[model samples]
Target chain A: MRFNDKLRLAWKKNNSLVCVGLDPDLSRLPAGMAQQRESIFEFNKTIIDATHDVVCAYKPQIAYFSAYSAEEQLEQTIQYIKTHYPDIPVILDSKRGDIGSTAQKYAVEAFERYQADAVTINPYMGFDSAEPFLNYQDRGVILLCRTSNRGAGDIQDLIVDGVPLYERVADLVANQWNKHNNCLLVVGATWPEQMAKIRNIVGDMPFLVPGAGAQGGDVEQLVKAGKTADGTGLIVNSSRGVLYASNGPDFVEAARNEVIKLRDLINQFR
Target chain B: MRFNDKLRLAWKKNNSLVCVGLDPDLSRLPAGMAQQRESIFEFNKTIIDATHDVVCAYKPQIAYFSAYSAEEQLEQTIQYIKTHYPDIPVILDSKRGDIGSTAQKYAVEAFERYQADAVTINPYMGFDSAEPFLNYQDRGVILLCRTSNRGAGDIQDLIVDGVPLYERVADLVANQWNKHNNCLLVVGATWPEQMAKIRNIVGDMPFLVPGAGAQGGDVEQLVKAGKTADGTGLIVNSSRGVLYASNGPDFVEAARNEVIKLRDLINQFR
Candidate 1:
């Protein structure tokens, strides 16, 4: 099935858009720094087990995994998540973009190795770099139109040919990539107004929103700004807000509570 | 020492500005498919062995390794080169850029994990993303200026506020990142005119020029246009033109012949 159809089906079947980010920053791991590689798998297993019912997808930021000893370890971490939690779609937040040939490799890594349902990409390299990723039908290629970070506006909001850089990127991803519509835009929740503007430009494509908890972005305002024409297509991500709910021993339970709370809030708005 | 100081020393020591690219394309591996992973390592070993003394540096485009299972293998390849051929500076051709936190992780991965002597970065996300890579003294961060590609003019040639995007990026990476002065610009050999313009703007910073050889970039024009004030600072790369010099068993020998030819051409121009 196409990514959009799968996303819609999964969203309806799973009843949530909460994507638990598996960014297990080594410094912030709940326990076992000595077992750096295994901790990610262990922590992710509990998080996935606890929150699987309430979320439509899981986003494992590749940076955190790739920071370890070897690519095999990174693969192991992602593989563990996919092996056990087969139903939940994995969005590998790799943010990879390069020339055509390299892009093909990244595509293989994301789709073949980790078998991610989608991978976050930076579109700054132009459409050529992104074409390889967008070519995948069963998977998705999420472009950072406007990121959730504070400095995202510095460049992404710059006026280029009158339209902001992010707006221009949004137009390109939606229009040029519309031949496949395998592209999704990332509009951070921190910028509600820009999100609404991007929502207009991007039309019906799904948006992966990251900034609800740790970044202190307003969820109510975000829901207001991010509703698509079909009243769907928003993956609200919370990293530290949920995962690190309790640094103590009851971390998993604390995480469950946090995810349930966020899910309820999103559901109420939806 | 600065990147150019190292490049100049190596160039003088090796009597060549040639940087052999270790682009281990799976389909074109010297050995058959069964040993694809091992063949990539073996191919790189031979290239490094044959041209280590002749070439100033080795550029392993991260994408080629990423094309395979792509996690541990890419890291392993980088480690192998650095450990086995420690004298040869490995310039990881990864044009990475993102917000602050993500940038930090990428820096750690490139500088710490891969132990890359230098890395190619994208300036589209602005200096903040590029700064982390520039923060280290031992490593150099090469920013993409006027790229050497068919679509080089897409966003790169865009005149923003008065300056072309590549020129603007060159100025930013040159001036802003000099807070540490560990910055280099990736100016293409194809855009020798623009490369000179960017060099004039970026002053003494080193330039890693790509798009020579099989890309049909004019070596003479590139040398004439991009000569530094001291008549150096160019690391012209030739991937397919060198690595895939032959489809037959003399592939390694053919690659060496190609590099020797390009090296003599560059030396003659110099």
Candidate 2:
């Protein structure tokens, strides 16, 4: 299935807009969860099992896996998700950008090798850096725009022509690069006004909204500003808030509870 | 030993300005080589052995290794380089960027897991995205500036205020971020004028200039425009032109010959 089709199906079936991030920091893992690949995989497996129904997608940050040389564990975790929760697509959050040749290898790494349904890319180098990912006609390529951090305005908010850089990015992606119809934009939920502006520019292309949880974004405002007419155009991601909910033995349950609450809150807004 | 110190030592010792990219594409590998991690490592070993004397640094693009699930081979290759060619710093060409927490993981991946001396990063998300990589006071954090590709100007050349965006990036990196003296910038050999302009802006900062060979960038102009007063500010990289010099069994020798020609050409211009 195409990435958007699968995402639409998952959204309808689960009635959710939550994208749980599988970012496992060694220092932040539960007590007794030693810094090993096996523990990380096990923790991910438990979290996946607990929150599958509440999630529209699973976004695994590549840095967490690459940090420990736990790529095998990451692969296995994706496979486990595919085998068990087949409808929930896996988005590998690797903001990779390079020239054409290097971008091709990254495409292989994200799509063929890791079997992720979608991937994130940085748009600094413009079309060439994102072309390889967009060539995957069945996959989704999410580009960073209006990111959710303090210093994001340093460059992203730079005025070009008459509009900010992020709006220019949205215009470029919406008008120029969405030929394949598989492109998405990442607008942080913390900037609801910008997200609303971007939503107007991009029409209905899904926005992978981060910063809805520990990053201190208001979920209701984000949903109100970012949702499409059908109320299915946002993937509100909560990584630390969901994954590290409780360091105790009931961490999985706590994560499940947190995702359930976030999903319901998003649905109520929808 | 700091990264720049090691790079300077190698540049002076070898009297060369070539950075050979280890972008081993599986389809481009020599015939009869089995598709296994061991074979990949062996191919890299042969290539490194042949080009170590002629090149100043060995840049292994992370995408190529990650594509074939050969990250172990990448690890082993870096270890081999450290043991065998200690002075030649290994720059992991992973243009990684993310938010603060995710960026932290990427820093761990580049420094702790791979143990690379330097790394390439994308600055699209602004300062916070580059902050985690910059926090590594000992290692080098090379930011992407004017890229070598054709469409690099789509966003990079967009004029803001009165200057182009890339010059603005140079200003930011030079004035704000190089406090630890571990910052570098990427300027494409394809745009020698821009390279020279950037060179003038950031007086002595090292420029990782790609697009020398296969990308049709002129070597003499690049060397002349990119070199510092001491003739040691440009690390011109040629990947496919060196690696795919010949598809025959004499590939290593052919690669060495190509790199030698590039190194001598750069030195002649110097």
Docking model 2 quality class: high
Error of 2 at A109 (Å): 0.6
lDDT of 1 by residue, A1-270 (tens): 677777787677778878888777777777633446767776777777888777878888877776774456556656766677666777888888776777888898889877788998877667777888888877888988888776666456667787777888888778776577788988888989989998888788899998888888888889888977566779998877887898888888999899888988888777
RMSD of 1: 2.2
Over B123-161, each residue of candidate 1 has an lDDT whose tens digit, in order, gives 766657777787887688888777776766756776667
Interface RMSD of each: 2.0, 0.8
TM-score per model over all chains: 0.94, 0.98
DockQ, all models = 0.53, 0.86
* Second chain alone, TM-score for each candidate: 0.94, 0.98
Residue runs of model 1 more than 4 Å from their true location after superposition: A32-34, A73-84, B31-34, B70-85
Q: What value does the lDDT take at residue B3 in candidate 1? A: 60
lDDT of 2 at B68: 86
Q: Write the per-residue lDDT of candidate 2 for residues A1-270, one digit (tens) a residue.
A: 999999999999999999999998777888778867778889899899999988999999988888888998999999999999999999999999998888998998999999999999999898988999999999999999889998889888888998999999999999999999999999998999999999999999999988999999999999999999998899999999988999999888899999999999999989
| Candidate 1 overall lDDT versus native | 0.79
Pairs with steric clashes in candidate 1: A71-B71, A71-B72, A72-B72
Q: Model 2 chain B, TM?
A: 0.98
